[model samples]
Target: IGVGTCIMILSLLVEAYGGYLLTHPPFSVPYYYVLIVTEESLEMIGTSCVVGGILYAMRRVSKERLKFS
Candidate 1:
């Protein structure tokens, strides 16, 4: 549970950073192409991780339940 929560929080931070880069490109860079690509990739990866963690946690919980006959 703790690990999952930590992963989710880290994912959120990565997503936010990517968003910021997308919206505000560095001045030294003439083109924003790299920023766009990086942002998209980061967002996709972050979302995947978050979803995977949630599904894993859910499965773990469900599997732990005792069955009553």
Candidate 2:
């Protein structure tokens, strides 16, 4: 869970920065396209991490029969 959370957070930071750059791009046309691709890829990775983390937590809780109020 910790590892997944950390990865997602880092990816989010990358996405935010990437979006800002896309809006105010300082790179040339080719690099700008590259940035767009990278940004989308990172977002996908982040979403995957979050989903994985949720699944892991659910599995652990079920295995331990833990309940939250």
TM-score of 2: 0.62
Once fitted onto the true fold, the runs of candidate 2 whose alpha carbons sit more than 4 angstroms away are 1-26, 66-69
Taking all chains together, each candidate's TM-score versus the true structure is 0.55, 0.62
TM-score, candidate 1, is 0.55
lDDT of 2 by residue, 1-69 (tens): 565566667767766766676688474777657766775676677678778889988898897886655
Give one digit per residue, the lDDT tens place, for model 1 in 1-69: 455455556656666655666677564353345555555565566667777878998888888895556
Worst 10 residues of 2 by lDDT: 1-10
Off by over 4 Å in 1: 1-30, 66-69
Model 2 accuracy (lDDT, Cα)? 0.71
RMSD of 1: 4.7
Candidate 1: clashing residue pairs, number: 0
Record all residue pairs in model 2 with backbone atoms less than 3 Å apart, i.e. clashing.
none
Highest lDDT: which candidate?
2
